[model samples]
Target: MQGENVSLHCRKKDANSSYTAKFYKNGISIGSSSSGNIMAPTVSKSDEGLYKCSIADAGESPESWLSVADLGFPQVLPNRQQFFQGEPITISCEGLNGRTGWRVMKKINGDIRICASTWETLIGSCNICNAYPSTDSGEYWCEHGEIQKSNSVNITVSGHPTVPYFKFYLVLYTGLSLLLVVILLILAGLFQHHKHQQTIRSHTKEMSLTPDDDTLYSKAIYTTLRPGETELKGHKKRAD
Candidate 1:
């Protein structure tokens, strides 16, 4: 853990195979070898997965669980956060190096560099690598072996607009349009209420001018008729 020199290994003679051997971590089936010994590159958090080696042949069940230890991914740092597509991007990964697996690594792209004699050898170099618009957009993670992945350095590249961009724009405009429609509906309701109040006032005045004989004993407009308002309207207006 302190140095990258930790080894959790086992041999394969327990099996019936004169064949090669393979190593695994947290159930990750890895490389094969003719020898019984399996060596670890560097261990890290991502390597925290279960580790065990399998023989090419069914020698014996002795190749069972070897190690279930926590593996840390090496830390990688990038020079800049942004880049242009098809351009170079560099990321510096930090970890103890030397034990054979010290190589610059790229996941999903499988670009493993071998100058990894020393951890510092790859630093300052910015881990220079190329970026393509389609492939490199996601998180770019690197590790020595299954060791800690270098601290992620994202190199987002600028690119030409695609059809998806247009779809996004259209979705945004549709959302705005719906919001505007709701606002207009609310304002129209308010305007209608205000106009109804003015109409009620007009109806009251028209009723006020009605003859006293027709008025009978009521000053309420419910006793008189107003244009556009019938008995049904009068009953509804009075209830309001």
Candidate 2:
């Protein structure tokens, strides 16, 4: 009896209670008393397996066997489990059944992804932390070993597809091209206006000068600078 009280009873020839009692577990003597009975209370986890009780009477010993099973490993179920992408998951193992380790397996698009560990107790479920759709998506299961396995759980990754956003990008690119053409046309118009302004300013400044007026203007400036230079030039021309 693991984690329970135990009593060693020796069957008598006629329930006479006239014999002595002794107990042995796994072939080791545990307790014996002269009162013909033995009771062990609060049996710990270590006490398990087949036990035998013997009674010595009139120089004869008779023995009988008893089996005690303890509370051992935890339970592992398959029907109600799941897995998701980017989230690593683990499963609990039971019995001494060669856990060796546990493998978290998933059938992802007809492919398998597995992770293994040797533990009887699990701190978290098989669905790992912070699971996301694009990175971690697939059908999954918790595998114990080649000998023992659990049920399969499909991991459906839910998210929006990228195709619609790509189409939006194409639409934006076409709109940008139209905007660039309009900007170029506006710039060309502004350049034409500035060139026209420069031409008008040049034409207005040159209109103040005529061919005859240019000669009169030069004579006026020459007469003011020299008093008799023109008369001396005429005398020198006559002498020659």
Highest TM-score among the candidates is held by which one? 1
lDDT of 1 by residue, 1-240 (tens): 422444545465555546665666555567666665655555443444455666545442343433334333434334455655666665444443433334444443454433234555553234446666555553554455454444444446667545656798899999999999999999999999999999999999998888876455454444445655445422544323
What's model 1's lDDT at 186?
100
lDDT agreement with native, every candidate: 0.53, 0.53
Clashing pairs in 2: 85-136, 86-136, 87-128, 88-128, 89-126, 90-126
lDDT of 2: 0.53
Local accuracy of candidate 2 as per-residue lDDT tens digits, 1-240: 343467666555756556566767777888776565677664544555566667675432444444455333323232323333343433343332433454455566666655324344432244345556644466554444333345444554444435555688899999999999999999999999999999999998887664575576555232222443433322322222
RMSD of 1: 17.5
